[model samples]
Target: MNTQPSALANSAGPVSGDSAAAKSRVLQIDRSCRLPLMFLIACSLVWLVAGGFLSLISSIKLHAPGFLSQSSWLTYGRVYPAAMNALWYGFAFQGAMAVALWLMCRLGRAELMGGKGILLGAFFWNVAVKLGVLGILAGASTGHSMLEMPGYVSPLLFVSYCLMGVWALVTFHFRQERQLYVSQWYLVGALFCFPWIFTAAQLLLVFHPVRGTLQAVVSGWYGHALITLWAVPIGLAVLFYFIPKLFGRQLHSRHLAAFGFWTLAAFGGWGGMHAGAPVPRWISSVSIAGGMMMILPLIAVALNWHLTARGAKGPENNQVFRFVQFGAIAFFAASLLDIGGSFRVIGEVTDLTVFTTGVKALYLYGFFGMTIAGAIYYLAPKITGCDWPSDQLAKLHYLGSVVGILVLVLGLVAGGILQGVRINNPEIPFVEAIRSTIPFLGLSTLGGLLLLAANLAFLVNVIRLLALCCCTNCFASNRSPAGSGPAAAGANL
Candidate 1:
């Protein structure tokens, strides 16, 4: 029941003159990073569309191989990897970076410095992702699951990440706030851990390939670390920041928050190896134990969020609150499924089929993607000094996204179970197994279409908002008094 030092020291309080100045500085920092963040978000949206297209194609090829059999590039093997890489690197990572940068600035209570360098880094990061996706399509992939990008492209990504990481570190070091909140801990840990984990994986898996099953071990570790250490923390940071703010309350339990963070850090790395690779029995056991242990942190987080939001009213009509709530539920559900699937009986059936894919989609789209969307919805108006262009568009996006992800998860889970059962029974014809999956695959494709439509609506709304901000800035700058141009323009924006 004792609170951690960070939790006790970092409690929110009333604003004073110093705090008011900090708020002003935060606004300036946001303004400085606005363009770069927008660029990152826009690239993410574009990649979402591209990934969606490739996903649909890949899904279709599963049931109807002859649909795009003419082109070698469009073959199922290449297209599936391409779709995954585009979503993981292109859309997910970019959106995470945007969210992370904003959180770092706000929580650190520092004005953003080195904006140009971060901007340049973001540009090259996108370039590397683009080249990596193209290389994957061109059959230059290194055959590693998540690290499939060619050897040549890895350095570009690593260097760009280092550049971005340095900016984050520098900002953290110079932060005006002395006591770090839970969100800052998550944000800092994720930023620092990513480069290390990624570089090690690249070196072991790509630069100097590991032998045999060790490569699989490293790949599993990398994939898990990417989600648990990087993506999950980013999502959690946003949730931790916004939940209390929206609900007008303090966090439910600081002690629980501390416990959750440390426990997750301890167990998440080992948990990823449970994907039933052919490594060793002890490895799988260790992973299963890790996965089971994860339930503690998951329960801790769920309880904390629920307690924080208890008695909160009117959030259903708010876009940001609604998205975060949905994301929270998805995260808890995904965790339960992950733990359940770690059992030998379930893992035997689910690990090698589309069920695993469903779990992953639940995390990436339903959890991380939804939370990021909420953060964007809440922050965009503040950053641009303009409200959302249309509430109707936001409503459509929310509905489509929730419906699409639910349908996709359900279809994959049901189909994967059937496929797993058929595969285990060697007497069943492979053709029949394939035939059984056709209907579910079709449903998944429909769900994907709905998601794509939602993303397009979001992208259009963002573009309109950005254009308005740009026009406002220009008009304000031209009419500003001498020596006050920059200040006046910023005020208008």
Candidate 2:
């Protein structure tokens, strides 16, 4: 009785009495959490657009240093980190929080009853991110890679995170359903583990100010954990839940899933050592080994997703599947690329270079961003019961994202490798080496522009949907919603 009214209605012609009841209960869960989740989504969208602009600025600055050189607050040192934090903390994390809460409620077969706390927490989280970004721009940063926010900001973030995160755990704990899905495992783990890691990093690196290179070690550990244990798990949870649910199939293998989960949990945190970290040899050795061992988990997860998606399910939500398929491929590819980077040769050359930027693009925008984009599309219709207003816009958004990321990643990866080679070669002057990469930087700027355009399209699409939900049909049609088929969902992208 995993009820999805629009998804189910799109695939199948009719629903039984049980499905009708299930849909009712599901709708209750959706409605219970609607305000907070939608508020989060809305807030996240703003940050996404704002981040895109900041990203565009940063990208332009790479190739053209004189564009906005007058403003100290807009310098690359400040703006780059600000853009990164905005997207990571503001857009990605908020979207994940909303999606995670919805999944917890759905899997638990319970309403998100106490939602005011979540809304309040989300509000505070936004305020924290805003103030934190301002701090970074105004030169009050703590100077850590991921933890750039001022020390004062971390506590508020932690408290707000706990507010939203605790409710998700409560929902999971009080689940009406006895059996927990694979997604639940990842979500629950991500929820608890991220806070633990974040808190530990704050204590050692920020509050206490660790001595010597140990500070770098802590920062590296926190950065890696942010993506690996926190962001990746949240992305995977959505994929694991949606792929099976959308395809109307059970997960391919429980054993494989268990193996994947444990492997990731065990080996994932053992990472964080840089190419030539000043830490002990054994530390880097352990990290490299852990990364190499991650191949097993990657294999398990990839196989499970592939096997689960092999079956037939009529004209599925084209938009949903398209995004998921791309995201799944990106996830696997990024994981492989990341593993490859663990080797000495690749690590040495690519360390602190734009090649690493390519990997991040693959991970952040390609995998997590796209998955969440699809989820937003799917969830929007379900939550608001409004058919998409425009297919062209949706397709445009997808195209821009896909093409932009490809161009951006390719430019950075190729440019980065070239830059690394020049840096390593004694004959090449350092300044000359930097100059040679300008062409590639221009290419990335183009890609950034495209991504910015794509996000703007998404914003418009969402606005249109809101208009439909609030006006026109005026929510009357929302109550007893009309069906949405492949044609209706269209190559909604």
Candidate 2 on 84-164: residue-level lDDT in tens? 899999999999998898888777777674577888899999999999999999999898888999999999999999998
lDDT of 2 at 485: 21
In the order shown, the candidates' Cα RMSDs to the true structure are 4.0, 5.8
Which lDDT value does model 1 have at 173? Answer: 78
Residue 470, candidate 2: alpha-carbon lDDT: 70
Model 2 TM: 0.91
Which 10 consecutive positions of candidate 2 have the poorest summed lDDT?
484-493
User: Residue 487 CA error for candidate 1 (Å)?
Assistant: 12
Model 2 spans with C-alpha error above 4 angstroms: 1-18, 311-317, 472-493
The alpha-carbon deviation from the true structure for residue 453 of candidate 2, after best TM-score superposition, in angstroms, is 1.0
Number of the predicted model whose TM-score against the real structure is largest: 1
Candidate 1 lDDT at 310 equals 89
* CA lDDT of each prediction against the hidden true structure: 0.80, 0.82
